[model samples]
Target chain A: MLEVKDLRAGFEGSEIIKGISLSIKAGEVHAIMGPNGSGKSTLAKVLAGHPSYEVTGGEVIYNGENLLEIEPEQRALKGIFMGFQYPVEIPGVNNAEFLRMAYNARQINEGKEELDPLDFDDILTEKMKMLSMEKKYRERNLNDGFSGGEKKKNEILQMAILQPKLAVLDETDSGLDIDALRVVSDGVNKIKSADNALILITHYQRLLEYIQPDYVHVLSQGIIVKSGEKDLALELEAQGYDWLTPTN
Target chain B: MTTTLVDASDQAESALLNLHKKFMSGNRPPEALVPLNEAAIQRFELLKFPHRKHEMYTFVNTKELVSTVFNLPGETVVSKDFIKSHVYPECESSYLVVVDGILNEDLSDNSAIQSSINLVPLKDAVDQPEIKEYLADTIEKENDVFSAINTAFISQGTLIDVAAKKQVEAPLQILHVSTGSASGNVTSHPRILVRLGELAEFKMIVKYVGVQGNYFVNSVMDILVGEQAGVTFSQVQEDATDAWHYSKTRVQQGRNSRVKAVNAFFGNKITRHHFEAHLKDVGAELLLNSVSILNDAEQVHHFVRIHHEAPHTNSTQNFKNIVNDKSRSSVDGTVIVNQGAQQIFSDQLINNLMLSDNAHADNKPNLMIFADDVKCTHGATVGQLDENQLFYLKTRGLSEKVAKELLTKSFAESIVQTIDFPGVVDYLENTLLKKLEA
Candidate 1:
């Protein structure tokens, strides 16, 4: 469902991720474990086509479509979702309004009938139920005064409502509490199907307990150095990333 | 100096001398600070109108009317039914009215007005020697010629005294309407004096509308909030297309008091002016907001002065302007904190949405603080609507006009978000629709 070949990205002129590649199949959860500044977030942002991160090299193929040249918003329309590590706080924009806009942006690209307010409300209530979230989350300002946990939960709620073919969760667990993490993971799990995929990026083994990835990859410096089954997460959790780096 | 705007004939000399004589005597309205006013007028007469070298009045060129004697029309608006139909009542509180720059019995509702709210016309207040003494000692001003000119004209204005520990039921509305021009230029000074007592709560809306054409309106409103008095003051101006409105407001807030003012200018040829909250005692707060949609050759200039005088003073200043056509706008925000006033928190934000390449907006929001413990922030930005956001909205099914309306609402949400009164919000939205025709 998702493919990346020799992906390289950075901020401005300084390249960070030298060259890296990874792939994930449908219904499979892939965890990218790396230390801070190890390009774990960069991979997600670059795949999502963040304008600040220039794709210095490589192509990202999502469902047989090359997404390197598409706009970040267009990539979202093409069923590519990147849960930002730090979502920008856009004040004065309503949460429901933003979600409706994102949903309609994709619908426009797909040539589908955009839902009206009543229709969108009906859809939203069902998604909120599936995601095990409250209905009031849609009325507040867009992450303006939201707590870290609430912001993360709202991101998952977006993922559930958007229902992208391939969803990437980047550092969604850093700030969430245990209950919020469980709810968010449940939301991610509910959206997964035979034709959908999710990429979980985390430094700890806690989120792995909820999502249970089929494949675990140990990313170091700018590249993924190890690829294995779910057991690699437990080993890495016990030892940590300091032991994975090659000694000079 | 732009004194050269005066004619060279004998008429000019006598006019200048007539101007000096008319401005120098009895210059302070309500007879407030008579000596200071007289001395200030002397200094003001010595200097001519500011020239292009002065950056403060750079975009405001008043060379057209500096030489004209705009007579105050004698046909006073004295119909009681007309006043009752037009002006909102303050019978449960206090209110006053100035008809053709003179306090009229038919215009003001004073007697039977709530005892908690003391409503007195400035002319009648002047007749009371003790009240005149109190005003003459307390009110102060620098040598601003126009303000002093307002004093010399000394027509009439309402004196509203809201008693301490009283909350007025309805908003106190002061309606100032213009009519009947007698010459090339006709002017009227509708003065307003409001003194909200301690711990009292009130909302005052000053509405300015013109019924006739080619008139000049010089209006000033003075508000003094006593300790712990909470007040919300707003001004709505939708003057006639052929009129010019010059309005200035000066307010003083006392200890633990809250004073907020929003000025919405939807008029022709207006120069909106202000000085606010010069003395903020402990825990006193002030909020100033202005919104304008400029069109054609109309020019709107907003001058704001926020001074924090005591510790723990809080203030906010925001003005959103949308300028189209060849219109020009200027916002001059000056915030100052005294040397002894500590822990002052102040913010000034000005945003202009320019709809035409030739339209212009000059925004200067500044702060001067002598205190050490303070939080101050000021910013100004002029930009067209974001193309990405606009395109995104259009693609989402909102038409271009609806999208523009939403964008404008978003731009103004911060100010309206703080407004709690439904009538104010509804009236403002209706006036906005009628003003913009969108």
Candidate 2:
């Protein structure tokens, strides 16, 4: 479902994702893990069309469309979702109102009828229950004063609503407690299907325990140095990245 | 001494001269208002008209606006349909319609209002000494050109007096409509005086609307909140594109009195508003909130001053402006804490959002503290919408326009949400949404 070829990206003339390539099929979950400053988060942002990063070389293809050529909003409309490491705080925009707009935008893109606030409330209630979010979360400002766990759960709730073809989870488990991590991973695990793919980017193998991945790739210095099965994560967790460093 | 009227616009000179000549010719001058008119005209002749060089009129040019020769407005011929269509539909309240500067009793309905609240035309109550006192007391006669002009020509107005310890259930709606004269440009001077007795609670809405034409409107409002009284006053200005308007609201609060004021300016060619509040005794509170949404080449200016005379007083001022096209808006606010006014808390915040390169906003906040123990802070911000917030909305599949519209709506929503009237809130929300979409 996703193909990346020699993707080279960076910010302001400094190369971050230096010459990397990866391909993943449908129904597959890929976990990209590495130590700090290893370009793990940069790769996720590059694929999600973050305007800050200038793709100096290579391309990304998704569902036969050149995803790199599209805008971030177009990428989203075409079933691509990015769960940020730090969700922004929009003080005045209501969370439910924002979710409805996103849902309706996608509906319009797919040539389907839009749902009004009353109609969308039921769907939102079911999703909130799945993530154990309180009703107050919907009425509050979008991530304005939400706790660390609430923000992460809200992101996953959006993922469930968008039902994107490819989901990029960037440090989704960084600030979450044990129970929140399980809830988030459980939400992601339930959404996984035969036609969708997810890329889990994390520094610890803690999240892998809840939502196991089919492939684990060790990334260092902007390049995927090794690719292996789930056992590779256990190995990296036991021994730090010093043993896996490529040493140029 | 022959007043020189130095550095004045030709139009302002002409307008003042015409009005003076008419007044001197004994054109139905009331016996009680002759001295007041004479004094105001003398002050007008002395001060002339304020220009850009004047400190208070720095960013606005009053020369061109005062130069236009507006026909002296008289009784207007308005249809019932016009009056009905223009009334605010959101809230069902008693309406007092002032047409072309005259209080139209036939058009005003006060049957629904509580009996404890008194609504009467100033002209009818001019015989009472208290009516004369309010008219002469609230506004400053010296150094204020517009208020003097309004006083010099005050013919019709409304006087609302609330009974002591009485709470009015429904809001009082004062609708001021200016319909251009048959011949040419017309000007209207409307006045309002609201007095709430001790422990009285009331809410009032003042709406200024005009038809499309060359018209000038000068309005003055005097509000007095008694001891332990609470009043919420909301004003909306939606004038014609060619209309020029100047309004001043002066408030005096007694011990422990509270006042909440909100003003929204959405239309006008040239609009200027002045708000002054004096906290006379301890524990008085004031909240002054305003929003200006300007587009095209329109201009709006707001000048506010709050005086804390007694200790333990609190005041808050929040103002926002959204400018598009080549429009310009400015706000100048000053909070003064007297020497004995210790333990006072004051905060002022001004935020401006510029949608285009040509749009401009000038914000000035001043704090004068004579007491060392007072807590006062003021800050102003000017910029476009947050790029990250916009991008986040876009990533949620919203178009750029929708994203910006939502963000702009959010900025204004912070103030509009404080309005408890649902109909007024909905109307303001839709109005702001339309402006954002445009």
Candidate 3:
């Protein structure tokens, strides 16, 4: 579903992701674990086509097409979804209206029928029940006064509504409590399908316990140093990331 | 540096002299308003047009009125087609049409609301006792030059009197349409007087519509809310591109009365609005909410003041301004708590969104708390749209233009949603969207 070849990117002139290559097939879940500032989140943002990150030297192929030239909105239309570490607070836009518009955008891209307000309400209410979100959240502004847990749940709610092909979760468990973390992980586990892929980027190995990953890659200073199975996560959790860091 | 108001331009001085001559020669109604008109003329003579050097007129170019030749109120040739096209199509209301400062009997639709209350032309209400008492009670004609001008040269207006305990469901629509003069620029002064008795309820919608010409529409409204009464007044100003508009609304609330005033300004070359609310008795309440959108070289100004004269009174002022291009807008809000008006709660907020680098927004939020127990808060914020918000919306598959329109519409939605009338909210939303894109 996704392929990256020597993906080197950065913010101004300094490179963050230095010559990292990774590829994943459909129905597979990949976990990229790294320390702070190890380019885990930068890879997610670059793949999502953030304007501030310049692609120094790299190529990204998604769904058998070159993805570097696509705009952020077009990338979204092509089923590229990024769950931001901190969702932007839009104070005046209604959450329900925003979700409906996003859902309709994808349906329109694929030439599917768009749902009206009444029909969308039924679908949205069903999804809210799945995520255990209160109906009142639909009436409030999108992430305006929501707590940390509510923001993460809102992102998951959008992910469930959009049903994108490749979903990248960047630090979705950082600010959540134990209950919220379980609920979020449960939501992602429920939405997984054989035709879609998931990329879990995190600083800790705890989230891997909720949703098993097919492959676990340890990222250090922008490059993947070790590739192993779920047991590698336990190995790293027992010993710190220092034992695995490669010497120059 | 020192400044003097006596050194104003000679052209404006001559303009004032010509208006005085027209006022003297105009026919009188032989009513109690004659002396009030004379007193207003005397006051206008004492304080000519406000100059740019004045503290209140510093940000505004007061000379815009003096540079052009504006004719006095004359014949109105407004047709039925113009009136039908100008009013809101979907909103249902009882209409009162004032064309070129003259009340048109044939164009108004008072029959729809005939059973609610008393609505009559001001000139015909000379014999009514309530109209005589509330006509010039709340407005300050002696200090405000425009108010003085409106009083002296008032051509035609309305008088709305609600009987005790009467509640009117239909909103009274006052449409001030300026069909520019055929000879030269025209100036029309349309006045309004509203009086609600004890426990009475009323709703009014004032709309200003004009043709494309060099014209000036100076409007004034006086409202008196009796004890336990509730009133809501909404004014929507969408004048012509070449028009200069000035409006002043003064309100007074008795004990336990409530008043809510909403204003939206969209189109004008230069527009200035003054709003004042006086809590005359204990437990009086006031809410002043305004929204303005200006682009290009258009200019809009708002001067708002709320006075807590009695104990246990509450007042709130919220204004949102959206400016783009090279346009400029200013808002000055002041909340005054009297010496004995303890337990008073007043707040003022001004939010400005500047879309372009050259657009200017001058905001001043002031509070005068004489009583130590009063609680008053005021703040003003000016900023561009959030880039992170834009990016978030774009990632949801919305194009840049649609994202911006959504955000801008959301900025004005909080106020627009408060309006419960059908189609009014949609009309305002569409109009604001068009203005933002323009």
- On residues B382-438, what C-alpha lDDT tens digit does candidate 3 reach at each position? 998777788888888887888888888777776666555545667788786578876
Estimate TM-scores for all models: 0.81, 0.88, 0.84
Q: Individual DockQ of the candidates?
A: 0.13, 0.55, 0.53
Ranked by DockQ from best down, the candidates are 2, 3, 1
Output the lDDT of residue A90, model 2: 82
By lDDT, who's the top model here? 2
lDDT of each: 0.72, 0.84, 0.83
**i-RMS, each model, one decimal:** 5.9, 1.3, 1.3
Docking class of 1: incorrect
Candidate 1 interface RMS: 5.9
TM-score of chain A of 1: 0.94
User: Would you list the clashing residue pairs of candidate 2?
Assistant: B11-B67
Candidate 2 residue-wise lDDT, A1-248, digit = tens: 88899999998899988878889898999999998888888888788777788999998999999989998889999988889888898877889999999999999999999999999999899999999899999999899899988999999999999999899999999899999998899899989999999999999999999989999999998888899999999999898787887657
Global Cα lDDT for candidate 3: 0.83
* Candidate 1: regions farther than 4 A off: A101-119, A122-139, A245-248, B1-48, B54-59, B64-116, B127-140, B179-184, B211-213, B240-243, B266-270, B293-298, B322-327, B351-359, B379-408, B427-438
Two-chain complex of model 2, DockQ on C-alpha atoms against the true structure? 0.55
TM-score of chain B of each: 0.85, 0.93, 0.92
